[model samples]
Target: MVSSRIVDYHEDLVEEPEVELPQMVFADGEEPVGVRVLTYQSSRAINTILNALNEAEIQYLRESSFGKLIEIAEKPAFSGRFARYLLSRQLKVEKKHEAWFRFAGNPIRFSLREFAIVTGLPCGEIPKKQKMKKKNINEKPYWPELFGSMEEMRVSQAVKMLRKKTVTDPDIRMKLACLAIVSSVLLSTNLKMKMLKEYAELLGDIEEFLSFPWGRIAFDMLMTSIKKRDEISLSQDTIALKGFALALQLVIVEAVPALTEVVQDACSSSESESDDDEIESPVSKARRKTLNPAHAREVDRKSEVNIIFN
Candidate 1:
């Protein structure tokens, strides 16, 4: 009879040399990159908008160009461990700026086109920033109209302003949602990220603003964050990554079928596990020949397009 010892590879575990580094360090060795994703409570801002609006207003928001944002706002925050794990698999290429990750051994590119498909956001070539700035030169500044005269307000403060009974206009409400989503969730560095006049300018012409490639802008920012993390050496202690880090996680989750089951919120119970004891994703098992071939077929059948919130 065939020996069970040969079949049970799980029992063939061997100890590998440790990288010998401090806790929360993933910039070196054979381990996954230990970068953490920093995101704000986007739900709060979204709730504020929902509560402040009437039925017509809510429905209008649902049908707007920025409508998909409502779904993104409610998505479960990506697991920090999984986020780092994806980053660790990022393959080095001849072009330093090209973002690529090895998923179940196949290379997946996180290009702007993929980002757009995953996010359903506009990905224009000319940045929204430049377009907004150019508008400022031509006519009235968008800041005065969109945000009013709050020079030093936090992103939450901007979202909270909508709560006042006076902000009943639909345009103003839409503008508020745009600002809130951008600062509080999309490109936020932290909860205290300040309001930027550049983005506010886009809100002036809602139609034009919707057409502008926000996905490209956001993807670029996300790419920039990844590049920075890549540059960090083993000695650096950069733990937190900002600016739409969740997008990177989202694209990876969309591409890798096995990862869909393992993705968790950053604040979930998985946080309790040590880096060495991190919950292995199914792809990890497949890599080690531990996963059944039949299971892989089931994974392949699941739709790759993971849009909409559950």
Candidate 2:
């Protein structure tokens, strides 16, 4: 794992590596912005949000070279029948950033907590203040009505009602059913990393951190909790491991820059300490192959940093 000190150094702009490659290869006039997501987020949530925003006819700019959520938000010449919007979009995920909505824009900074309420997840464990602001969803979605005619019931009860053979307990069943419908709503986005050798160490480090973080813990808890009640078991670890393995395979092929630098430094010092008087036997001399002019030129052409990236 990358130490907090190392991450802090990068964040503080104390040690920026000199990157020569084109910055993410975006087109001219393009820029990136960071967007923060809320808890219980999923890719479908992102799609739904985008769909709503797009339907509302807003214009925006892409804040990331990659990232699906950011890419769609930033596409050029994308206008709606209503308005012309121009702003950047991208998701900023750090272990420390809590679940909330943060827009990199003026006017009002939207929070995911607010977004959840807007999306009608009012009964899904939000603060009392946020819950008080719930819109008149009475005319909104009513998959809730099918579960049963109930008042003051738990989500578990609603879920039980939906899954049972018949209408056993209407009140308890209705609540659980409502819970199921509400929980099924989409709320976030994700971009699967591309497989490549140059990202090996970065991938490895992220995996190490996320395994013990919310990524793994939340999934584990949700899966375990649901299985006993619904008779539907999902092995999150198995899924996580599969994803980790694919990511690892790509990152493992890339040389770790820090490790390589240490090795090169050691090699240089050892060579520098060696004396010119060092000698080899006649048999050893005969075993050493002579370098051709082309080979010598090739050796001189390689840069240390270039070698590392390769």
lDDT of 1 by residue, 198-240 (tens): 6776776777666777777777877776766644542232245
Per-candidate TM-scores read: 0.67, 0.20
The worst-scoring run of ten residues by lDDT in candidate 1 lies at 1-10
Q: How big is the positional error of residue 166 in model 2, measured in Å on the Cα after superposition?
A: 3.4
Residue 191 lDDT in model 1? 48
Runs of candidate 2 exceeding 4 Å displacement: 1-28, 31-88, 91-108, 116-165, 186-310
Please list the C-alpha lDDT of all candidates, in the order they appear.
0.51, 0.22
- lDDT by residue for model 2 (39-104), tens: 122212222223322221222212211122233222111111000011121122232322111111
lDDT of 1 at 297: 32
